[model samples]
Target chain A: MKNFIFQNPTKLVFGKGQIEKLSELIPLDVNLLITYGGGSVTKNGVYDQVKKALKGRSYTEFWGIEPNPRVETLRRAIALGKVKEINYILAVGGGSVLDGTKLIAAGIVSDKDAWEIVLSGVAENQIPFASVMTVPATGSEMNGGAVITREETHEKFSFGGDYPQFSILDPEVTYSLSDHQIACGLADAYTHVLEQYMTTTGQSRIMDRWAEGLLLSIIEIAPKIKESPNDYELMADYMLSATLALNDFIRMGISQDWATHQIGHELTALHGITHGHSLAIVMPGTLRELKVQKHDKLLQYGERIFNITEGTEEVRVNKAIEKTEEFYRSLGLTTRLSEENVGEDTIETIARRFNDRGVAYGENRNVTGDVAREILRKCI
Target chain B: MKNFIFQNPTKLVFGKGQIEKLSELIPLDVNLLITYGGGSVTKNGVYDQVKKALKGRSYTEFWGIEPNPRVETLRRAIALGKVKEINYILAVGGGSVLDGTKLIAAGIVSDKDAWEIVLSGVAENQIPFASVMTVPATGSEMNGGAVITREETHEKFSFGGDYPQFSILDPEVTYSLSDHQIACGLADAYTHVLEQYMTTTGQSRIMDRWAEGLLLSIIEIAPKIKESPNDYELMADYMLSATLALNDFIRMGISQDWATHQIGHELTALHGITHGHSLAIVMPGTLRELKVQKHDKLLQYGERIFNITEGTEEVRVNKAIEKTEEFYRSLGLTTRLSEENVGEDTIETIARRFNDRGVAYGENRNVTGDVAREILRKCI
Candidate 1:
């Protein structure tokens, strides 16, 4: 196990009507800016609940932060935040809004351009930001990292900043979510755990079990959630699992492979695929392509997660990868690139992008530009 | 799932050589008081490492906080802290020292006596405290709860207070632990998970998995530690698991049954048995006595932890209880009252103590004085 420091101070206010805590959760004296994505919160009654909670509190509202939160859009939010002299940020919608608000929070307090912060891979200073987290994807509510896309260059990147002061996760708010959103959310969460896991085995036994426990719970609950979306317990598990996945809880003293996510972000940037669905497509390919490197963990994953113990080592690994793709397809997502009409040209573009950035991904840092092409081709 | 507000701000500096980070972790300007258990750290080299790190820092030293940390010992530390106007506490030895320091932190600030603070069940105000934990039991390093024994009354009670500002857990420090201490530590860590779990099923699937994950890691590591106690990775897992087991990460939305712990505390208070060994003796009896109430979770625990299949429902539950006792005994700890030479008189005394307090334990709050007697009788 590696020497590490772990601290996460985000107070998670979870369960039914937790948004009612919004008034007490956010300080009344701070100049607050509430950020949102589209108008889904309005239709879902989340907006009304939040407004009711923050009844007399004065706040500016910024809407239309798109999925795969765009930097171009966040720049305007930052400008508005600067002009309004906003001291606090409350992201009131899904992960995308929260992700954008992270950048806005950083940009408002620093002279650095919002895009510059993304490029630097860290937010120097961030105004305290939190979330009424409606979607269970990205884990932006509890974690310090945010992935923001630059629309002009078709690039998406993550930057580190302050974790939310608090996150209000009322699972009932997810009842009105599109089935596809739920599917993608589950996929994103599952992939997040896999990325943290699926590296070297035995680095930390507790982390492995936690990652497995999380995955097992996710896999068990995913189908049931489709059958019963409003089931409070299942969505509660989903929301909590997603937060725990990337919030440095399960990754303690272990290496992580975000290669799948790094590749998935390119898909989202270039072709505008939903973040989680892109992961659903890419993760199986990353597993299949990197089978030999991840052989032992694949066998364990196969047995523990997929119950694929009755096979040869090679067969079990292949079966694990296949079952993962099957799991994604079971979530109503296509697991192949061609099925989504994403072709070699886009794959080559992503490869060139990795090459241009001189970035190597994954736990071993071996997933260079050419290696990414191979993984993407496996998806094809 | 229950509505919950979760936040633990204790920074965990984990792995080898973490004690070197003490100077940086603790605020240098504050008046610091370093507390310790009976000199185990002196021989283990933990005290030297701490002193070396804190060479330039001015601090007062308080020693001899014995096992099950007594309010009597803590009062002296508290008095010393008050005299020195100590605003920061760094517990240098095991959980007892840390637990004692927790009380000292509370007592130094309040006009009330140390025992009065313990009797209050919650410490209203506490000076900041941190730990260089040498023991892998109790989990006092990462959590706000501390179990302190009242020497005068032979009463053991847990009180809530401020979490450690930071905890340095270097598994290397655990190498000097005696085999018995290791046994008790493993037992303590395992029972901690069971108290949080072993309640009703399906409160939160993720939490259950994480709890199970922690239990499985401990079970797998216990025997190996007996063989190779100094293995860095195994001890690291042990240290990490013990902290994670009781740190509110697993009990988020679930009802918890600490009936075993409640009974175990009585055993410790009356008999002076090691904390973890007391749990080992009490837990199986708690399971056997409350089998009907905890049937579903017992079955799940049996199947998941011990793989106790191929039996009737009653047989499986009985086997599960037996296996739990067996696991404790495997750790070289006596799991029965007669084996430890305690008789009915002690049991009755504990029962009377619970009766006097008018307290009920367990998830459903049904473990009254008479119920505790039944559980203790099962242990006999």
Candidate 2:
């Protein structure tokens, strides 16, 4: 196993009515700014609950942090934060709001432009922030990484910074989510585990088992959740699984392949596909194109996750890739580029963009522009 | 699932040559106290590594914290800490050294005696402490709980407080461990997962799967470790398993049964068994006595961990319990009180102690003194 250091300090306040913890979770003395997305929280009663919990506490509010959290939008939040002298932030909606608020927190404390911070790839400092996490996708609640898009440039990039001081995850809030949102969330979480798990085997046995466990739980709960969306236990599993998936818990002392996510980000940026849906389409393609490189792990994943043990090595690897795309399709998502109307022009654009930047992604750093084009061509 | 709040802030620095990070991990200004066990580190070269890492730093050293970590030995360390006004502590040996340092951390900051703090069941305040963990047992590196013995009264109790600031776990340091220590460490890690897992089913599917993952990893690594004790990957798995088994990561929003640990602590206090060995002997007894109450979970454990699916419910439960005992025995530890030469007198003493304390344990709070007696008899 490779050497690693791990530490996550986000206090997870989870379960029913945990939103009531907002008053205590956020500090009493700091100048607070509560950030939110478009008005879904109002319809879902999350806004009322958050307001009631923080009753009599003075704070500013910023709304309309979009899904692929645009940098153009977050710059305004940063300006508002600077004017208000906000020392702490409370993100009240989903992952987008929290991801935007991360940039806002960084912007409030530094003279760097919000887009510059994203380009820097790390925020040197940020004002403290907590969240009333209403969405389970992206795992922005507990992790330090955030992906923000530049609308003008049609680009999306992630940056690392301080984790939330606390995150209140009341699974009951998820009962108001749309089916499409739920599907995307499940796909995002499952792909998060695959990014950390579908690498070289034998690096860390515990990490492998843990990644598989999360995959198994996501797979088991995905169908049951469709049947019973309001079931407290099922949503709790989904919420917790998403947070644990990307919170550095399963990637300790191990090689990780986020090539699928890198390609998916381009799809989201260029064509405005939902983040998780893009992954559902692109992950299978990456797996199929890189099957030989990931052969051993694919066999293990096939056997452990899909019970595909009665096949030859090559057949098992193919079966594993097929089963992965099928799992995403089972989530009511389209697992092909053509299904989303993304064609060769967009694929070539992404490949040329990668070539222009001279970037090679994945565990072995071999997924160059040509490899990405091949992966996308397979998806088409 | 239950409402819960979870947070762990200990930074785990793992892999070879991590002890060199001590200078950067600890603060430069605090008055530091370095704590140790009975000089195992001296013979193992860990002592030289620690000293070399902190060469220019001024610190005090306290030695000779024995197994089970008695309050008697810790009081002197506490007194020394008070005299030196030590505000930071670094434990450089195994769990015993860290456990004793936990108490000393509490005692130095409070007016109450060390034993009083232990009996209080919670330390309200403690000076900051970190560890260079040399043993792969007890999980004191990442958790806030510590069990300390009162040698004068033959009593053992646990208390909870602040977690370590950081812990350095270099699996290479485990190469010097004796075979018996390795066996006991493996058993301790395995039993730790069982205490959290072998309760009611369906509280949280993710928690159950994660706990099972740890159990499977431990089971797979135990025999291989016996043959290749010096293997880095195997030892890394073992070390990481011990830390994760009790690190509050798997017990979120779930019922936990520490009854085996409760009885095992008594065995340690009375008969002077090693902590892990005591658990090995008492755990199977607890499972056998409480089989009816833990029926569903026992069946699940049997099916998942040992693949004992070819039997009736009762037969499967019995086989699970038997397999648990056999696993411990295969670790080269005796799993029965009779094999260890303890008899009815010691059993009665432990039962009377529990009865006098008026404590009922287990998930249902029904492991009373009578149940304790029955469990002990099963062990016999």
Candidate 3:
């Protein structure tokens, strides 16, 4: 196992009607900014609940943080926060709102441009932020990562900042989500586990089991959630799984492969695919292209997750990949590039972007630009 | 899932050679009190590492916190801390040392006797403390629960206190543990997961899977660790599993049954049985007596952990109980009172203790004194 330091201090307030505790969770004296995305919280009654909870608490509100939350929108929130002297941010919608709020938190404390902070790859100083998480994808409620899109350049990049001081996850609030959003959330959570788990084997047995446990739970709940998205228990599991998936709990002392996410983010940037849908399409390609490199772990994952034990090595690996794609499809997601009308031109553009950045990803750092292109072609 | 709010803020610096980082982890402005066990660290070279790390930094050392840390010994440390006005504590030994430090942390701040704080069951204020953990048992490194025994009264009780600021867990430090200690540590970790998991079946699928994940990891590692106790990877898994088992990660929004632990603590208090050994003996008995109430979970645990699927309902439950006892015996701990040579008297004492407390445990709130007697009879 490798040397690592792990600490996540996000207080998870979870279950039914948890948003009402928001007023008590946040301190009384801070100048607060409540940030949101494009009005879904309003339709879903989350905004009303939050407002009622904070009835007389003084705060400023900023709306219009978009899906794949863009810096262009977040700059406005930061400007509002600066003028209001906001010391605390309460993001009240999906992952996008929280992602944008992370930037505003950092922006309020520093003179750095919001995009510059993304480019710098780390934000050390940030005003405190909490979340009333209405969406279960991206794990922005509990993790330090935020992927911000630059609309003009068609680029998306992530920066590390501070975890939310608290996140209120009322699963009942997810009852009104669209089927597509639910599908994407499940896919994102499942892929998050795979990215952390499908690396080298035998680094840490507990981490391996934990990563597999989340995979098994996601796989088991994906179909059940489709049957009953409003089932409080099912959505509760989904919400908690997403937060735990990428919150640095499963990656300790272990190698991780985020290559699929890097490629998927490009698909979202260039072609405007939903973030989680892009992963559903790209992950199978990653597994197939890198099969030999990931052979042993694939065999283990195949046996443990899919019960694919009664087959030859090649057959089991194929069955594992097939089962993965099936799981995403079972979530009502399109698991192919052609289905989304993405092809060689966009794939080449992503390759160029990766090449221009001079970066390699994955556990062994071998998923270079050309390698990413090969993986994408397999998706096509 | 149930309504829950959860947070743990202990920073874990883990791997080989992590103890050297402690000097930098603890601030130097406060009067520091370093606590230890009876000099096992001195022979194991952990003492030299800690001393070398803290060279040129002045601190008082408090030694001789025995296993199942007694409040009597801790009172002296608390009195010393009061005299010195020690503002920070660095517990530099095993769980017992840290457990005692937790009480001293609370005891130094108030005029109340240490035993009074233990009986109150919660310490609202405590000075900051951290640990350089040398044992892989009890999970005191990452959690706020502490179990302290009072030697004079032969009483053991637990209380909620503050978590450590940081903990340095170096797997290499576990090389010198006695075989009995290792056996108990494995059993402790395994039972910790069971206490959280062997309750209602469908409270949370993710929590069940995570609890099952820890159980499987412990079962797989226990025998291998017996053969090669110093293997870095195995010890690292063992260490990480112990911390994760009780760190509030698996118990979110779920009911927990610590009835076995409640009974086991009494056996440890009365008969001086090792903490883990007592659990190994009591847990199977708890399962056998409560199999009807815990039938579904026992069946699930049977199928998942031991693969005991080829039997009728009653047969499967009985086999599950048998397999649990077998696993503990395989850990080199006695599974029955007969094996430990403390049969009826110890059982009677434990039951009386529970009866005197007028409390019930388990998911059904029915593991009362009479039920405990039945459980104890099963052990005998």
Candidate 4:
């Protein structure tokens, strides 16, 4: 176990109709800037619910925060926030809106550009933000991480900062989600757990079990959620699992391998692939490429999560990787680069980007540009 | 899942040498009250460490807070705090000392008697308090709940409100704990999870998985810890499991069965059994009495934690109960009322007390006094 400081102050207002409590949760005096993504909240009735909750409360609204949360749009939100003197941001859509709002929160308090804040890799001066989370992927509702895409250079990067002061997670909102969105959300959550897990074993047993637990829940709920998308209980479980997956709860005193996510983000940046779908495509490849590095933990994960205990070591590892991609497929996601029309050129471009950035990822920091190319080739 | 709003604001500074961080963690401007148990900390070097950390900080030291944390001793601490006009408290011992300090934190601000505050079941007003936790049992370091015994009446009760602002969990401090203390701590943590879990099945899958994760970790670590009592990683797992067990992190949007704890507290108040040991003795009994109500969860727990998949439903449930008692015995705690020399007379007293108070517990709220008697008889 490693020396660490852990504190997450996000007040999770969960379950049915929790958005109604939003008016009471936020303080009465702050100048509010409610941010949203492209119009899904409107179709889903989340916009109406949020408005009903904040009835008579004066606030500025910013829409058109895109998926993957580009800084190009967030800079505009920040500029508007500064003009409105917005002291509090209320993000009212999916992870993208909340992730973009995180930058706006930081940008409102500093003279730095929103993209500069994202590139700086840490934003220490953030105005407080809360969320009415309509999507369950990315865990932006509870965690301090935000992955922002740069439109100019076609790059995506993450910065860490303040968590939401509160997040209203009404699982009922998930009933209106597309099957593809639900699939991506489940994949995002599963990969989130795997990113934190799939490392060296025995660092923290509780963390391992917790990561396994989230994976099992995601796996179990995926098929059922497909059959009954409006199932309140199933959606609630999915929503909560996503928030718990990357909220620093399961990574306590443990090593994490975000190599798959780093590769996946590149896929999203270069191709405009959905963030979670890119992870589904890349994770199996990373696992196969880095199998020896993550051998023991993979074996344990195979046994615990997929019940793959009756095989030789290599057979079990291969089966575990197969089962992982199968689970993503089970969620209706395309788990291969070719299925998404991504090919050698894009893979080489991602490798070039990594090499240019001099980036090395994974638990041991050995996943260099060449290693990434091999992983991507395996996916192809 | 149930409608729920959850937030815990306690900052945990964990791992080796975190006590030295107290000076920076606590504000120097506030009047401070440093609380302690008897002289064990003095021998363990935790005292010198805390003293060294707060070398220049002017504070009042209140010592002799015994196990089970009697209100009798805490009243004196409260009076002293009032005299010194202490607005901040830094409890530098185990759960009992910190639990007692929770009351003192409440008492120093309110005009009401400390006992009255405990009886009120909620302390709305409390001066800020934090802890340098020396023991891992009871989880008072990171939670709002505090159990305080009223020694004069041989009665024990709990109150809720105001989590510690921060807690320093230096696992190195646990090395000095007695083997018996470690046994009891492990038992306490195990039962804490079962209380949150072992209730209705499927209320929250993540919560159940987290509870099961803690239980599995405790069961696996108990033997290894007996062999290497001071192993940093093992003890860190133990210390962390204890805090996570009762920190409201599990039980989110779920019903809980604290009937074991409710019954266990009676054993503590009556016979002066250590808090955790009492739970070890009573929990299996609670399971047997309530097995019909907790059937599904018990089976799931059996399969997950103990791997009782080879048996019939009844056989698995019984095996699960037997294995739970066995785990407690593995921790070197007495698991039967007969082993502890408490019998029907004490059971009757607890039943009478519960009946007189018109109290019931468990997820279904049906573990009334008579049911408690039946549960206690099972223990006998």
Superposed Cα deviation of residue B83, candidate 1 (Å):
1.4
**lDDT of the structure predicted as candidate 3:** 0.92
CA lDDT of each candidate? 0.92, 0.95, 0.92, 0.92
lDDT (Cα, 0-100) at A90 in candidate 3: 92
What is the docking quality class of candidate 4?
A: high
lDDT of 1 by residue, B303-354 (tens): 9999998789999999988889999999999999999999999989988888
Off by over 4 Å in 3: none
Query: Which candidate comes out best when scored by DockQ?
Result: 2
Which ranges in model 1 have alpha carbons more than 4 Å from their true place? none
Tell me how each candidate scores on DockQ against the true complex.
Answer: 0.92, 0.92, 0.91, 0.91
Tell me the spans in candidate 2 whose CA falls farther than 4 Å from its real position.
none
Please give each candidate's TM-score. 0.99, 1.00, 0.99, 0.99
Clashing pairs in 1: none
Residue A37 displacement in candidate 3 (angstroms): 0.6
> Compared with the true structure, what per-residue lDDT tens digits does model 2 show for residues B135-244?
99999999999999999999999999999999999999999999999999999999999999999999998999999999999999999999999999999999999999
TM-score of chain A of each: 0.99, 0.99, 0.99, 0.99
| Clash totals for all candidate models | 0, 0, 0, 0
> Looking at model 1, what is the TM-score of chain A?
0.99
